[model samples]
Target: MLIGEVARHSGVSTRMLRHYDALGLVRPTGRTAGGYREYSADDVRRIFHVESLRSLGLSLQQIGRALEDPAFTPSALVGDLIRWTEDRLAREQELLERLRAIDASAPGDWQDVLRTVELMRELDSTSAARRQQAVLARPEGESVPAELLAGAVLAESDPHVAGALRWALARSGGDGVAALAAGLRSEDAGIRRRAVLAIAEMPEAPGAVAVLGDALGDPDPTVRGHAALALGRQGVAAAVPTLVGMVVEGSHDVDAAEVLGTLSQDPERADRITTALAGELAAPTADSATRIRLIQALVELAGTSGPEILRRLAHDDDRVVALVASALLRVLEERSRTNRADEDS
Candidate 1:
């Protein structure tokens, strides 16, 4: 076949076929009457083979080695090509994600586009400080999309940066909650913990309470604890059970106690809180430490009703518990007297 015919047959341009010949990748075998290059069947086959290898992302030099060097092993070159392709693919995928985030932000001009791009870069920066600045550096009237903020919060390890991201998400109008909710269901325990922490910071978010309510049953203690504390502060009575358990286990018991006390302002919830604490204290298998922690929480929930529980604990078998409870009882008595005096005045 002539070069033009070959180009027509193989879908390769004649110019490229000549280039292939110059590179010794595929040389025509004979000359036609016009002294033009004419390809034999084997030459056309080689041209097709070179095109096939090129399709696999082989460079011309590598293709030459693949076609001509009998001693050359393709395994190493193929592995290299695979790695190169994977790297290119990763870059493309990352770019696609950045574009998606920017598009989601609905940038109105080149400045907005640049701002979104810079923010995305900074959010992924190695320096935690840069990531934090990216979150806080929002231009007036412009904001980072919540999905990006949510993604950053879930992956952020630095406490300060994570806090800033959470703040940003909270103010982003709750669009990120859906994304953060997905993180709540992540199999990675760390991601799940971060998700709950971020969501807990956005109590005003739409459906934030419901998302947190689901996290109350998270297998991870940290997740459940944070969810319980946030929900308790939000006045969700469902958190009362976990808040009471936190007191027994000594995990954030102080915060849990304070939240429980706030929840107890309602007469019904107050009874439930008091009853739950007393029941845990009376468990036959309750260890001394657990009982002691529970006692401290009860003092935080101090009222006319809990003095009886404190009085009983004051004389208990555990000397430490007795001493702590007796001290708390005295403190509770002092506060009660002061309140009565004020009411009389």
Candidate 2:
């Protein structure tokens, strides 16, 4: 067969076939006495195999290596190629995810895609060993373990991995969701903290919400803060009442302020939250530090409620009052320029 016949049969262009031949990636078998290149049925079969592997997204180097040994049959090479293809597909998915995450943060740019592809490759490879471990164990049970999944999730620095883990947990069944939520209930404070952070990004399950509520009373104020913050992000309105009820009832003023900061997004919820926090701020037992936090939440929550709350906080002897007041004015001023973001839409 001629090179053109082989190219036509294999779906490769003649130019590409010649280029492949030049690269030693794939080559024709022999030449005619008159210097015409010739190929056989076997050559066509090899070209087809090379084309198939290239279509599978393998590098030319990989295709060449796979075709080197006489003992390596097409079926065997394809089996190996299948595994590579799966990993390649996974990397593509991760790239899409990272691009989504970046686009969420800012506008799309060519640089973002380039950075995302790099990050995606890193994430896909990082979790491979842990996924292999999970498959190897099988656990005498159904789906994979959460610890292995957690390892897979934490292996990547990108926020999209967190989102993917959360979605994966939700899809696996209620049990995976339950185990992930249960992580927030871990006795070790550090574990609880990390779990709260991870699960916060996870889908908000009722089980997870319940665990977060329990964690709100964690001995470490940081844990309580994380729990409240997670609940805010998860935003089950049912959790809103619990977060608010804890504010007037406890001394985790910083944590309470954070909850109020988030809940302030809802007018009805903000009124209830600030009303309770106001009482805490006014009481004789409240410290100057706690008062600072309470005032900050009031400032953050002050939509139409701004001047009234600002007047009260302006009286505080603490110098931070001035800084907080300045921040408020700055936010309003910056809005004049950056707030025009809607215009670009």
Candidate 3:
């Protein structure tokens, strides 16, 4: 086949075929009397081979080496090509994500588009300060889409930036609760914790509350603790058990105790909270430290009710528990006496 015919037969263009010939990659076998280039079957086969290698992202130089060099290994070259392709794919995916975020912002003009892009870039900045500023930099009356904030808050690891993001999401009035809810169900523990924290900051919406309630049973104690604390503040009675557990485990026990005290404002809930703490104290499985923490939590419960548990614990086996309980019991007794005196006066 002649050059034109070869171009027609294979998708390779005539100019490229000639360029290949000039590089000695694929030379035609013969020429006609007019001295035009002519291709034999073998030459056409080599052209097809070069095109095939090019489709695999091989450069012309590499294709020449691959086709002519006996020592050239396909394994190493293919591995490099695979890596290059993966890098390109990763870049494309990142760009796609950025575009999606920008589109989600619903920018009204090119300037708005640029601002949203800039905001997103800063939100992902390595500096926590910059990420925080990005969130606070939103122009008045310009609403950030909740979806973007939800993703940022879930992935944020820096405490300051995460706090700013949570505040921003809360101010958004639970618009992103659905996205945050998905984070609650994420397999990543860090993500689940972030999700619950962000949700806790959100305004009380039925959807957000439901997600928070479901998180009460999360296997991660930190997640469960955060959920329990949020639910306790929302007056959800289901959080009582987890709050009591937090007190016994001494994880955020002070905050847990405070919320438990709030929950105990209800007479029925107070009895239940008191009963739960006393039960944990009596558990044979509870160690000395756990019992001590539980006793401290009891004191933070419904007013004078703690003294009864304290009096009982004062005679406990653990000397530290006995001493701490005895001291707290005395304080409660003095407060009771003072209150009675004031009432009589």
Which residue pairs in candidate 2 have backbone atoms (N, alpha carbon, C) closer than 3 angstroms, thus clashing?
none
Give the CA lDDT, 0 to 100, for residue 34 in model 2.
Answer: 82
Report the poorest 10 consecutive residues by lDDT, candidate 3.
200-209
* Most lDDT-accurate candidate: 1
- Give one digit per residue, the lDDT tens place, for model 2 in 205-256: 5566777777776776666666776777665454555455455445555565
Clashes of 1: 0
Per-residue lDDT of 305 in model 2:
64
Model 1: lDDT to the true structure? 0.89
Query: What is the full ranking by lDDT, best candidate first?
Result: 1, 3, 2
Question: On TM-score, who's better, 2 or 3?
Answer: 3
In candidate 3, which residue ranges exceed 4 Å CA deviation? 1-10, 13-15, 30-48, 124-128, 154-157, 178-192, 203-206, 213-220, 237-241, 264-276, 302-308, 327-345
Q: List the residue pairs that clash in candidate 3.
A: none
What C-alpha lDDT values do all the predictions have? 0.89, 0.61, 0.88
- How do all the candidates rank in terms of TM-score, highest first? 3, 1, 2
Residue 147 in model 3: lDDT: 78
RMSD of each: 3.8, 20.3, 3.9
